[model samples]
Target: MTDFTHMELELEAILHASNDNIIVTDDKGIVLRAIKNSEEFYGEPSEKMIGKSVYELEKMNVFSPSVTRKVLEEKGEVRLLQKTASGKTVMAKGIPVFNSDQQIVRVISLSHDLTEIQQLKEEYEKLQSKVERYESEIEKLKKRETPLDELKTKSPIMRKAQETLKRVANSEATVILFGESGVGKTLFARAIHRESDRHLQPFIDVNCGAIPASLAESELFGYEAGSFTGASQKGRMGLIESADGGTLFLDEIGELSLDIQVKLLKVLQEKEITKIGAVSSRKVNFRLIAATNQDLKKKVQEGTFREDLYYRLHVIPVEIPPLRERKEDLPMLSERFLHQFNSKYGKQTTLHPETLAKCLAYSWPGNVRELENVMERLVIMSDQPVISPQLLLLDSSQTDEPQPWMGIESFDHQGKTLKEVVLEIEQNWLLRAVKEGRSTYEMAKKLGTSQPTVVRRLKQLQSDSK
Candidate 1:
């Protein structure tokens, strides 16, 4: 053979040996050539495909949306996904050949099967979804475990409280947390919610006293669009409705008005709420955790709080002892706060012995929150690594004095009888003891009396004042 014939035979051999399916068509969309692999990918022999019109093959279901036809119509290169009669998916690209006048002369089509790659991509997506689901479940488990872990305490009373909380954590019973202001009632409420089965849901907290009386009803029960003057055009969902399938925490619940109390009672009883200016009531499902520093029983007797509502909320009551009652936990609580603030402010500071002594001695009327704030202030403002007692902003004159008659001396008792004078003195002493101490036990210790004596005297004092 001649050199030109040898080169043509070599080129044909290379084209036929290619793994990719190759097809060549004339400008009129008739197949001029096809590779041997066409039989494998298109379920047709190369000799049969040759000399056939692409439109006829497409009509015969050999392959879909002929790539040669696309290149001919667009007069340019085209790329697309194609499915063959053999059910093989492919990535097909069509290239157009132009003559000297820039007119279409021939079309070359190349295709790569993507069936295996597509299957792998689908498998990867499924694995990714499973991993995401596992991560979400792990996060929920951590949340459920951390609430009780976060309650760091060494006091017997606090340990008992935690045990009680653990016992009722899984129950759907309404919880009432009673304590002095700043005694971590809100924290305990949140802990109870987190440890419950509803931890994955939202935790909605509303300070009943913080909301205005004018807006309390609408804020708790929601309102329809244009229900009242200045109402939002889109309407608003109430705090109770928004907490559905979650925990609704009402802090300072005693501050709600009597009218709102009645409505809240209905929600607790019926598990439903009605929006303002709406005819229908929507059912709501949620765990209720209410907190208050005031005496709800006293409020009930005085007609300020509803009696039936108080009982409903008083289910599984959790009384958080004040800081003074649990003074043994001070060191641990203080150290925890110090570590927290150190990490926050990037400081390595230690409290002085005298500082801790002063902290333990002073009556923390504001409870744990007060100590936390003081520690944060010391961490931020102190110039040295060792915090001293002087760094604590507690007033010595207010806390160090032992006289119960400090403020009483300023009152006018000159014209009072001796009997009245002695009665005033007794009342002043009782009040001072109660104010300085945490509970009746602590008050009795300070007054050199029994806990029952302190309780009885305080009860009498409360009655006399009323």
Candidate 2:
């Protein structure tokens, strides 16, 4: 082919590749060729319309107000919106191609359908509306908030556990709380549920160990009416179904039987459950938080716990530090519980410094729960305003865990001579004896000295200040 013909083909190829829908027709409005996209724009492929007339296409209601006819009549370019048979709209442009005679030989047409862009705009508006609605709901949820101050911790290990809870509170991820018993795993689970979007819904907390092994399956998965002996007349919803649109906390989940573990795994995988005698399953949805004081991985290895179920519950493992590891929080926790009990029982009880010292010295075998019971006992049983040190050791002898006892320092030796330190210790000992209402004879007997010597030494120490 000649260079002019080659350049012409190249130009046509560039026009066809352009984003615009280009159609070429003779001056008589007979369709000769059209770009590929024009078929989607008009609902008819270019090959089928190669020899068709634009007049017949208009009569067939393909598109109204033909731009090709306007270009022929006015002998110039025409651009306007055309209505399609699908009730959608398009922008069409037509230009007359003339030869050396200045008379029109062909009409070049380009059009674009606005339906897709319009649909996208509409969808964008709908998405914006949904976002606004959710933001408003979150704001309302923030107003009716749970007592998160209970979760405020002092130790670094406990802080890390709180962070994990906050991050997963708004999601559907399963969380497993690992810690010793009485470390507040149940409290953490409830906090997560209250802080979540499903706060308004029920929070079903089930303790696998608390329920008997004989009734465990029926209690968790429910039973149909008359399904077994002594069954309820009407079927009851189990803990799993009762937590729909909320949260499910399975405390001591490690204690569940292997048979129940397999069924629980199926419920998690399918998000549905069938009653004991029911053929069809009913759907349920809830966030799951599992807690265990036992070694679950060991159970998995021993075939007591299902491996699949362990992995499902182990999605986000948060280990809460036992109270022994975070002993620094003991003082604050003790004060809070003291005030709590004082207000609860309408008593004006205060913790004695000696009592607090003994509490700090002993390792918390039962963790926060033990402290709570201890404080409540002090408040209710104490007759005086200040609790006595004698009562603090009520049940320390029978505790399950060993007590790595710590003793309070008598005095600090910084910037002090040995004689001064000894004198200070003697004064402190005498003052403690006075606070305990011990006479000189009792003090002398304990220190292996005479009563007159104790009286004379106490008088000398008192006179040294003057």
Work out the TM-score per prediction: 0.56, 0.55
lDDT of 2 by residue, 1-466 (tens): 9999999899779777888878889989999878866667787777877889888888887778789988988999999988767676788999899999999999998888888787797789867855664566456445433444456565657877888789888889999999999988888887888878888676778999999999998899999989989989776668888777878899999999988998999999999998888889999999999999999999999989999999999999999888877654666777778777888788887666546545654567788899889899888889999888788764555322432222236345667788866765665554444333335666676556777776676545433422
Residue 173, model 1, lDDT: 90
What is the per-residue lDDT of model 1 for residues 15-38, given as tens digits with 9 covering 90 to 100?
788877899999999998888879
**Candidate 1 Cα misplacement greater than 4 A, ranges:** 1-146, 397-466
Local distance difference test scores for all models? 0.83, 0.78
**Judged by TM-score, which candidate is best?**
1
lDDT, candidate 2, equals 0.78
Top-lDDT candidate index: 1
Minimal lDDT window, size 10, model 1: 457-466
Cα lDDT, model 2, residue 51: 88
Query: Candidate 2: lDDT of 455?
Result: 63
In the predicted model 2, the residue pairs found to clash are: none
